[model samples]
Target: MHLPEIRRSHIAIAVISGLLFSLSFRLNQYFDALFVYSAGISLLFLPAGVKLLAVLVGRLPAIVGIMVVSVHLGASIWPDKPMTAIVYFAFVSLMTYPIATLGVMRLFHIRKNLSNLRYHHIVVLSVVASILNGLVHNWLYLAQGVTTSEELWHKSAAMALGDFMGCFVVVAFFHAAMGVLRSARNPQID
Candidate 1:
């Protein structure tokens, strides 16, 4: 059985991935949710360069950094309790990765660390993770005594979509670039 090696280069890409995600930041006043996102619908619907769960896990530090900055951007959503917002956001980001990773493993029968995932597998994981992201964020809103169900739904959907889109866009770009480089070196290869 082949095991996945933890490449420093990949890990570095992970860190940089967070930066790319950060570049996706934008505000949607309707939901009062400030978030970073990429218009990656084109790639999100398709199977792109979705990395393995273990590899993504290795990028936890960078992911956490991105989460901190992202949450801070929306601190005004809970101006009176900014700390509460930060803590909850951080907690969700930390907890989601492990739980979702387990979900991916069970759902896809992937026991190997950092093994390549199938396209459908990646899509399934993306949807599940998005729901988890939305649920946690929405739960926080409810806990804070917000009662507008419609707005709650909107916020959750926006946040989930933003994250998903950003990731998808980044993956698509990376794969496309690699393909271009590979094709350049081999004229016969397509």
Candidate 2:
């Protein structure tokens, strides 16, 4: 595709991904009693998976969408938080996927296109991403006095578990969908 076409497609992808992220966030809120673990953590944060998938497929531009939605949602989610804290968490959310992707890619020597990616790779990435995300975000929250040191580890674990479950669910569904597509494209005669 030409530069303009590529840009348009990337923009479209980012918008769609952002919408999906927003929807997931709303759904998580709807089931807040079941999914939420703390002020900023969910027991099943589907947006974490959406963020990962967007970066995996859409590259850097995906961050734009995720960041925008994150900031917007962060304000409403934690209205008492200062704008700086909201922005800070938004950035942390944006950084999570790229950091995880780069680390996983470098460690595994996986290709950028992820053509050689496997379920194990995804699992590893999810774990690394979730841990890093939970730690960094909670650390920042602690620094900002949003969370107490006593609650740090518990909050971090909650966040990590939520992110991991979200990533797992999304990746599993994507894998199954791809399998169905592949089978449809090359069906066997009985």
Candidate 3:
């Protein structure tokens, strides 16, 4: 099977995204500890938002970066875990953004340029992505006997909420930062 081409720019994006993911994840773990409800459940997962932004901008290459980092992180965090389990987790995490983005694209008929993208499109994407990530991860947990049925729905809901909020906060901050930069570059006539 033919693989997607990976150019220098893609590599650059991947490295940058991977670094950002690492930073965001560590920060989230350190500062959002109080918000953590369970092993994979948190109230404000900043990395989720960072992941979304990287996927949006870097596309497939970014996914590759995320995959690499996820595997690395998983392996490092669970050093005793088997290689197979770590790979599995990475695969599952890697699938979330692409599926959500493709689904949103097809559902909304958005162009590659995203010329028609709007605020609602982002909202829809964030919601769908968060739900998919939460549900898929929780289902895996249940299947692995890590979580019981009684805890599944609530855990999924909490994870989804965290993912959505993370995406919202990161996007909002990026937008505001861009606005400030623009204003600084071009001061309004008094």
lDDT of 2 by residue, 81-153 (tens): 8899899889976797889988888999989877677889889988888898888888988987878999999
Judge candidate 1 at residue 170 and give its lDDT: 47
Question: Which lDDT tens digits does candidate 1 get at residues 46-84?
Answer: 111132232244446545555555466547445677686
Whole-model lDDT values for every prediction: 0.51, 0.84, 0.84
Order of all candidates by lDDT, from best down to worst? 2, 3, 1
Winner on lDDT (1 vs 3): 3
Query: Would you list the clashing residue pairs of candidate 3?
Result: none
Q: How far is candidate 2 from the true structure (C-alpha RMSD, Å)?
A: 2.3
lDDT of 2: 0.84
Residue-level lDDT tens digits of model 3 in 27-117: 9988555889788678898888888878877888888888899999989977887889889977996689789989898999977666576
Worst lDDT run of 10 residues, candidate 3, spans 170-179
Model 1: worst 10 consecutive residues (lDDT sum): 40-49
Q: Could you tell which candidate, 1 or 3, scores higher by TM-score? A: 3
Alpha-carbon runs more than 4 Å astray in model 3:
1-6, 176-190
Cα error, residue 66 of model 1, in Å, equals: 2.3
State TM-scores per candidate. 0.57, 0.91, 0.86
Higher lDDT: candidate 1 or 2? Answer: 2
